[model samples]
Target: MFTTVKELTEQSVKSGLPLSEIMIRSEMDTTQKSRDEIYHRMEKNLEVMEKAVDRGIHEQVRSHSGLTGGDARRLQTYLKSGRSLSGDTLLQAVSMAMATNEVNAAMGIICATPTAGSAGVVPGTLFGLRKRMQPTHDQMVRFLFTAGAFGFIVANNASIAGAAGGCQAEVGSATGMAAAATVELAGGSPEQSADAMAIALGNMLGLVCDPVAGLVEVPCVKRNAIGASTAIVAADIALAGIKSKIPCDEVIDAMYQVGRLMPAALRETAMGGLADTRTGRELKQRIFGGRAQNPAVEEK
Candidate 1:
């Protein structure tokens, strides 16, 4: 629970503290904090995401398994070599990762911060942000605060767990959060932030959680990158002042409704979507061996 941006900003003005300092202090003091706890938590999560990006970038070089590792590494190397990675490169990294392996690397990045299963989205978003705009730590914190509010709204109204609300809940929620953050960083108002979130969620509604062989591989990994990209696009559109006909709250409600309509097979059970096919089973056997059993078949 965290105070709204309006409240936090007003309080900062009253206390004669810079808005950024107030945000940082509030983040550091997480115990028994007011509704503003969400802001603190999101900042904490973003810190985690930054660490994860370091790890992910290193992992790409070490394992040589990530999508277009050489290309991404080249871009990363250029950044380390004194050239900054652009937003386009960040977006390409996500797309390449998704195209290379469906496992959600960006979600893996986010899980390093938010949830292990949904790690990639936040980092992907942050990477894009760093590329597009070099905001100060305080600006980043404010952006995160706005994003956290959207995440809180989604959690309060719908669900973020894949099992509970499908992949849409996990990746979709991340996208909405990222989108809102992007909007704020791009100087959009709260209403625009909300609209970006709504658009992101609306586009990803009802996406099934169908990790192959019950692993957060396959579609999960790729989905995270895709989710990140979608969030950016959504935010950019909203920042341009394009309003979504549906409000953010209503979009969250729609997500919940769609989640309810999803079949159990599509809700992280690996019984449907790409997980249930013969190819998926073969891939599972190749990766996990004979111990893997199709839960659907076992139940029957």
Candidate 2:
């Protein structure tokens, strides 16, 4: 098991380093990379994602793809407006992106750490915290570190991929990450951070991946935003010092169990739920190709 943030913070204090620095150091150690290397890797990942989105948009236009145009445009608008996009916008963008293969926008957005197609939820929650609290750089970094820690735990113990663990992995993991980050930002103890994570994960457990198509557009994007908002709410409640009967570890285990019990058709394969409907099949045929139309419609 990982050490609590409180223990780590105390060690940092004893060592005369900032809490954020200590947290970063801990993460670096866990990943077997130096702090500079980790930072550089994250920066490079972000840059790559940005380039992918740009190329994806161009490809979509060139291919005359029927993918949702609103998502990329909305994200661009939100970034350009100088005012943060509402959580709703973020959610809608992610869900829409998931339902289409248009330039892999959903994957790109997830790379942005917004919600993960599911991307908007985590970033939206962080953005909300930034607007509401205006914390210093160190504070923001610490909060992100705390969030990352929880994410690592989830990745290790449960899952984060919709294909592997259903929507619970994507949305539930984002919610847990955001909840822990929120608690840390709000000056809650390490235990509180864990509690927040538990609450978020518990609430989102067993969420099915019901994308309207094999694409990452429709409900995936919007659901991310909703998950992000809920993470914030869960964190707020945890920060109030209310403890749950179940521990964070137990909640994570429960999520894993639930995910395993989910049907294969509901795991983002577009075979069940919303993805199996007549409308969904028609949409897929229109966007991709069909049995009659050369079956090889290349995805942009």
Candidate 3:
């Protein structure tokens, strides 16, 4: 029923319900499903994400296109070295984010936090938080529902599809959702959670969906890593009493406008941005056997 972050937060505050419970009730009301059914479904999603993160970090699986792999393992090793300048949780989150995306690239099972292309942020942050928060299993599941709450608003008010709103809509929204959920998990208020989302989304407002070789590798995986890292920082900012001047809903609307203004080549068509770089073009040719230019665009 809530269509904006302001409305969602106000409702949560007024009803004395956590954002996650509000989201769960919305899902139940919309689908006419029992609370147990909805919670079990989300639990299954969490299980899948955990497995994918475990598999990605522990194994060396390569994508069929040979575009991306192994970086997640490398990140994990780096994190264990005690030499990384990044904070422990931050590095772990980036690694887990990379791990999840690597699994996606390898075509392994992953729960699309919102979408397959930007699936890494939520689980990545959650698993990383386990090392710090040691949350109960049920608490972890609630984290996901909290994320779902923000994601629901974003998808309805703006977009979550890269083909529609570019990477800002995908990784951007995922990171924003993760940041909001992170605030809640860290025991921040619902208002702080909303501020976290606003900060995260405001920072990632104009990311383009420029997948090289039409594969969700390359920049996509790294972008997820960056998004996770950014989420942690944004959560910190919000929890520290800093607030976004532009509200969350307005930021999302701005992201949608920016995405609409983006050229078609920047959207998922792979004709611009990094997709058109020399190395990117060569890699595409090496992988797909040609430029793989759109036939209609070629004709036009």
Candidate 4:
């Protein structure tokens, strides 16, 4: 019944239980499902995430609009070149994040961690860490539970829908959840996990949901990549003992308020931001033909 980051972290610390355990216990109480059932379901989700990441990186997955495809493979090839400016972990996270979202765009099976648009971040960070940490299968599944814990707080206290709270709610919350889970997986304290979430989410405040052509291609895929990188960095900062001056719950509240102030055009309407750019509009007309020749409907 934890509805805020403060409550979630405090319980984790007091009970001497990992954040993931607390979430599993909470799920048991609420759903009355046996522990094995809940765990097995999450494990299935992990399997789906693994397959999506593998498929996207190994294949040239393209959306129907032809806007985003093969970028994840492209990034992976670059990683193999040994000339990347960023470290392998960061680049791998970015590539994997792009991979998951690209799969979603291509209509491939994907586990939507919070939503399909932001699905990449959680598995991205986890698989990225897998490259360096070598977590066991159980640890990998527990990583998801930890991420779900933070996501639960965000979804209950704020929003996870793009139309309701913009891209900040989608990608932003996903990034925070990934960061917190990364912290726990790295042996950081529950308090540090909360700090990681605050830092990650605060970094993405007010990000708009202006998907071109009202589709989850284009910026959405790239945004998940960036969110994954942000999550990794945020987790590192928290593990280094840095704290967010603004608490995790307050950051979430700020996100909600900012979303409320955002105009409808910026809230997934495809009538503003990159969606309204000349190139964006041109692509829209090309994709939808005469139907998109008309101007976007104004919000009354």
- Judging by TM-score, tell me the better candidate of 3 and 4: 4
Q: What TM-scores do the predictions have?
A: 0.74, 0.73, 0.96, 0.96
Q: Judged by TM-score relative to the true structure, which candidate is superior, 2 or 3?
A: 3
In terms of lDDT, model 2 sits at 0.64
* Tens-digit per-residue lDDT, 213-291, candidate 3: 8899979999998899999899999999898898888898898899899888889888888999999999988887744
**lDDT tens digits, residues 219-253, model 1?**
66667767777888888889888988987777888
lDDT of all predictions, in order shown? 0.66, 0.64, 0.91, 0.94
lDDT of 2 by residue, 136-163 (tens): 7556555556666677667777778888
Report the candidate with higher TM-score, 1 versus 2.
Answer: 1
Residue pairs of candidate 3 with colliding backbone atoms:
none
Best model number under lDDT: 4
- Name the candidate, 1 or 4, with the larger TM-score value: 4
Q: How accurate is candidate 1 locally (lDDT)?
A: 0.66
Question: 1 or 4, which is superior by lDDT?
Answer: 4
